[model samples]
Target: MPADFHRIASGRPAAGSTSFEAQVLPYLDAAYNLARWLARDDADAQDVVQEAMLRAFRYFDSFRGGDARVWLLAIVRNTFYSLRMKVPPDGMQETFDDDAHAVVDEQPTPEARMLIALDVGALQKALENLPHPLRETIVLRELEECSYKEIASITGQKIGTVMSRLARARERLRAELTRHSTEVRRHDVQ
Candidate 1:
């Protein structure tokens, strides 16, 4: 290895220090958003992010020559899966009924509605309705803005698999939004 590599590598402040904060803080909200989307609970999401950060700190040295976002997200993904595996089989299953959902109306801005129109909480519930792999792919690609290669690395799947899952996730989300809109219309009709 080139001698300059050591200085470049050691350029970052000590692990878990202010440097870690500088690097990790900006991504915190996004990471938590993703973790919450994946884990489906405030507490569990917090736990996942905390664990991910710790793991990232511990493994910071191994993160040579790669996108930090992907590295951090891979840790987050692993943390989510670890927690997911602990849930009981029955507790892990989710069922979504097309007939029961409502469509989302994107027309009204918050200023127009005088209230937050899009129920992010409801949308989050809908996202949680998806299968784990699909949910992970969606959160990483769409929410976290990870590229195909990054997503592939984080999920330990091939790029093609990431692309496929993202496609499926988009389709599922569209269907879900449509169902939600339909349900809203049904309620309006009644």
Candidate 2:
């Protein structure tokens, strides 16, 4: 569990007056998650987040804050777009396994772990295959658990557009996973 994830007695995020760092710091992992998926490289993601933080600090006064997380994420997403255009994606082929950073309690049996890996890997690859718009929408809505309104704010799309993309993304993901499972079963049968 992240040290920053603590909630107050009401089991809700604590509320307070906004200090730039204080507002942004708690959502660093969320920012990094968005960045990592956008960049598809962990190192690049970190660089994007660092640059995004700086941009946030530079423009702090403009934030007419409603939701600070959305504000920071918008900056992070834009920073990624900037990085993507300025630098070639091929410039860095380096990759890191996210499993390395994930903390697991109590090892699963080998059989269970292998099954889990297969499903997770297939879903991940399927997600990577989705078009950027669909992918981004799904990531914000599902993985980040943002509302349709929040997703629209982050992605600069209408709420209806966000919902449409999510529906399309989910259908594509389901098809991809089903195809993978069928192929695996066929291989096993042979």
Candidate 3:
């Protein structure tokens, strides 16, 4: 048997009892994905996820019967922020260029449209450029398919704040994609 199987078997709670793996492990992918987007570094994301999991395990007893995914994600977000605060502030400076938000022309040729099909690298870079709050909102709503309520709960924000952040994130993402598409078309013409 696989090690995981043995662990599950040995750690199985009695009927009607909460099983840690059953509730928490199932959400590991979501947790890791969120961490990756927030941390923007594979190793750092892994560290965040591991720390979050340990913290979740340590606090498992306090978890009431509710959405385990939300509970776990809340822990992940908190862990990521805690780790973020510990890093030296000097290395974290990011200059926000106002011109990056300028609206670009939207004229799309057939060829340009064809070339615009899901450019993962460009999209990732655009997302990386977003502020962490906006990026996290987009990831939770679009990537994780979380509801606004869930996002608000996980992020510890008001529902209105979550809505505004998501709206701004989408608008920024649209602007980024448009800018990227224009650049790609110009490159093709060269």
Candidate 4:
């Protein structure tokens, strides 16, 4: 194990003694990924991740011995929510249209099917369009692969709530992907 990760596994550091790179740096990717999904913008996600790292380092003494990823993710979620409260609601809230997301079965060509499989941009756009609560649940559960208990702890919700949110989020994601696939096929045909 690398020295930085070693420190993190050892648990709570002595007061002002732990290096930020040692304890907090190990989980930066997870932090940034969660932040990115929550913030839905590169710049905002970076800002949120930076703030989360700072806050985590400052409060390193409070962390008990356990999964550092979960701890860091919890901080990131809290920071994003706090930031959300600070900003006025952007008037651009998008309502999901079941009609728009409906799947139309036009027999797609082989190339179109391949392109749809590789269309990461569309999947990301669909995720971005989801409501924050649903998006966050999906990101934590599917993207981060965190357990329901871990997600519950991070989001401060009960495990049942987390499971419910994830189910709803997955259904919505399926609908979004179907819509994107149909649109991509249509574009390819035209």
Tell me each candidate's RMSD, in Å, in order.
Answer: 7.8, 6.8, 7.3, 7.7
Residue 138, model 1, lDDT: 87
Off by over 4 Å in 4: 1-20, 91-118, 186-190
lDDT of 2 by residue, 1-190 (tens): 2233332112433342136657777888889999888877888989999899777765766888799899989899999988888887676444446475433435898767777777887887888888778988889888888999999999898999999999999999999999999998888843
Position 15, candidate 4: lDDT: 41
- The candidate with the higher TM-score, 1 or 3, is 3
Sorted by TM-score (best first), the order is 2, 3, 4, 1
Writing each residue's lDDT as its tens digit, candidate 3 over 1-190 gives 1244335444544432347767888899999999988887667788999899878876777989799999999999999999889987543334333345333436877555444434655677788899889999999999999999999999999999999999999999999989988887788744
Q: Estimated TM-score per prediction? A: 0.72, 0.83, 0.77, 0.74
Q: List the residue pairs that clash in candidate 2.
A: none
Task: State the lDDT at 183 in candidate 4.
Answer: 74
Off by over 4 Å in 3: 1-18, 89-118
Ranking by lDDT: 3, 2, 4, 1
Better of 3 and 4 by lDDT: 3
lDDT for 122 in candidate 4 is 67
Q: Write the per-residue lDDT of candidate 4 for residues 1-190, one digit (tens) a residue.
A: 2343345445554444445456667888889999877875667788888778767876776888688889999999999888878877662233434344434446888766655545655676778778888899999988899999999999999999998999998898899889877876788744
lDDT of 4 at 151: 97
Output the lDDT of residue 131, model 2.
77
